[model samples]
Target: MSKVVLITGGSSGIGKSVGEYLTEKGFVVYGTSRNPENYKEGKFPILELDVKNIETIKQTVKTILDSEGRLDVVVNNAGAGITGAIEEIPEAEIKANFDTNFFGPINVIKAVLPQMRKQHGGLIINITSIAGYMGLPYRGIYSASKGALELLTEAFRMELKDFNIKMTNIAPGDFATNIAAGRYHAPLLDNSPYKKPYGNTLNLMNTHVDNGSDPNMMAQAVLKVINTKNPKGHYKVGEFMQKFSIVLKRILPDRVYEKILMKHYKL
Candidate 1:
């Protein structure tokens, strides 16, 4: 029987690319999108899923399990980005970011654990970000969300060790995706302290994302990790992110890392 893989947020970007790649690799792939109608016509099944809804996640998992009989890999890849300085963003915006990026994945994992644990083996690959490793200006909320995800991934890795389940966090720096232009931008308060100081940082973050690495390369990396006999707990993707994480780990200590980050953003 073919291995079963389910990917959330598989309508476009890295999720779509990974879904296409896995389907070509002979995995029985099931993809989820908020609107299944928007997905490109393909051989694999595309189900309607909104990760923010826990009930929807449970139903989606149950549907896949009913059809596939066994769930081998679950990719929690649905996430959104919000940009603006910390003080400029409203409380609602911050909560929205956490709900989609962090809590969404957590819900999916909780729903699929029973199926995976019953099978005694499965892979849970989370699409985190380089920001999860280091904070950046104008992306405080997005960073916080991914940071939460990184912690969850690590915790699950250790907790699921004896269950024969593996969790991998793939942190990609930049990818040639439309997410930059389409990122959720929070309204900046005129009286906000960050309005002037963090303005430049916001612009830089937007520019870099608009011109990142190829999304397909990220998809290929996903395939390699899943196909490997034993995947590492964390894998860094993208040229810039790979180099940045290395430099942060080497040249700068914990306190100095923040100094360098602030300097780079002119914060």
Candidate 2:
């Protein structure tokens, strides 16, 4: 039988791309959106899902298990971007970001573990960010959320090792998507301390995203990962410089790495 796959935030962007790609490859793919109506024309079945809602996650996973008998892979890909200086962002907003980007996947992972363990093998791929590796100016919270997710992914893998379940964190640098449009801007006032750099950093971030690699490439990376019996714990996807940044952080001193990031953002 073909493998069954579930991907969150699949209405558009990387989620949609990955869902379509997997469907084409003969995987029984179920892509999810907050509202299924908006994605009625999606290439794969668009299930109504809100990662922040634990109940919805459970129901959806249950539905899949009931129909498919087994679910082999789950791509936790639904999350939004937040742009602004740390202080300028509101507490509520930060919590919301974490809920969707970090806790959402955790809930899903918890919901699926039973099915995966019963099936005796499964793969969980968390969609993290390249920003998760290093803190960038004006995008601190988004980075934090991804960083937290990465940690969860690692810890979960360790606990699930003997269960024959697998997990990976895919840190994507950027891709042409609606994420830039959906990015939450920090509430700033006329005399805000971060006024100058706020605009500069937001623009630069968008520019990099505009020049980011294709979402299809990211999907292809996921495809390659799923085909493997034992996938790497972490996978980086994006441009050369962005991908290399992770390497640079490992070899360079802390201050040197800081300077490189600062210079890149003109901070």
Candidate 3:
């Protein structure tokens, strides 16, 4: 029998590309969107899900289990981007970012882990960002959210090791996606010292996103994890410069890395 896979945010970008690629490889793929109808004609069947809502996460998992009998892989790709100075960011927006990017994946994992445990096997591929390794100017919240997710993935990797389940964080540098359209932009227009810097930095950030690596490239890298018997804890997916920055963060001195990030963002 073919393996069953669940992917959040599958309507577009990396998620959509992964769904199509995996389906072509003979996996039974179920991709979720808040509104499933928007992708009814796609290669993979759509499931209506809002990762923030626990009920939807549970129900979507159940729907797939009811039909497929087994779910072997889950890709947590659903996320929202938030752009703004850390000071100007509202509490609600911060929570919203974590709710989608952090908690959303956690809820999905909780909903599926039991079944995986019973079967004695599963794979979770989290689409984290290279930003998670270090904070970027005006995108601090996004960095923090992914940072939290990465740490959680690390803990879970060990915590669930005995259960034969695997969790991997795919820290992608940038990929062409619509996250910018949905990102929460801080009101740095007036009475804020960050107005000019925010504009310049945010513009540069969006350009990287616009010109980022292809989503298919990410999906292809993720496929190897799915096929692996025991995957590593993390994988960085992107171009050389992007991947190199992540490598530098690990080896370079803290202050030095920060300076590079500042220069990169023109902060």
Candidate 4:
């Protein structure tokens, strides 16, 4: 029997790409969307699931288990993006981002763990952001939310070791997707102190996503991770420089790296 895979946020963007690719490769794939009715023609079945709602997540997982009898893999790809100066971004928005990006994924994992533990073997791949490795000026909230998930996966892996379930994170750099369209952007108030710099950084961030790599690259990477016998705790996929930036952060002094980022963003 083919392995069953569940990908959250699969209505479009990276999740859609990964689900389609996996389906082509003979895996049983089910993707999730808040409004499943909107994606009636998806390559694979798109279930109704809002990661923020624990009840929906439970129902979605139960639906999968009832039909498939087993779920071999799960890709926690549901997340929201928020961009603005840390000071300018509202507390509600920050918490909301964490709700979707961090807490949501954790809830999904919690809902599925019992079944996965019963199966004795499963893979949980988290779709984090390359930005999670380092804080960006305007996208700090997004970075922090994803970063928290990254760390959470590390701890989760160790805890699940005894159950034969594996967990890993795949951090992707900017990908050409509709993420920018859905991201919450704090209004650029004319009199706000961060107006000029925040506006510039926000524009740059969108451009990077607009010109980013194809989502297929991430799909290919996900397939590779799923096929591995003992996957690493973390994997970074993207342009050379984007992946290299993570390395640079490791080797460079904190202030030096900060300077490079500031200069690159023209902050």
Best by the lDDT measure: 4
User: Positional deviation of 83 in candidate 2, in angstroms?
Assistant: 1.4
Q: After superposition, how far is residue 44 of candidate 1 from its true place, in Å?
A: 2.9
Residue range 246-267, candidate 2, lDDT tens digits: 9999999999999988888888
The 0-to-1 C-alpha lDDT of every candidate, in the order given, reads 0.84, 0.91, 0.91, 0.96
Candidates 1 and 4 compared: the better one by TM-score is 4
Please write out the lDDT profile of model 4 over residues 1-267, one tens digit for every residue. Answer: 899999999989999999999999999999999999989987899999999999999999999999999999999999999999899889999999999999999999999999998989999999999999999999999999999999999999999999999999999999999999999999999999999999999889989999999999999999999999999999999999999999999999999999999999999
Report the number of clashing residue pairs per model: 0, 0, 0, 0
Better of 1 and 3 by lDDT: 3
Query: Would you list the clashing residue pairs of candidate 3?
Result: none
Q: For candidate 2, list the clashing residue pairs, or say none.
A: none
Off by over 4 Å in 3: none
Q: State the RMSD for candidate 1.
A: 1.9
Instruction: List model 3 lDDT by residue over 1-267, tens digit each.
Output: 899999999999889999999999999999999999878899989999999999999999999989988899999999999999888888998998999999999999999999999999999999999889888888889999999999999999999999999999998888898878888998767778889999999889889889887889988998888988889998988899888988798899999998988887777
Angstrom error at residue 247, model 1: 3.9
Provide TM-scores for the models. Answer: 0.92, 0.98, 0.97, 0.99
Which 10-residue window in model 4 sums to the lowest lDDT?
34-43
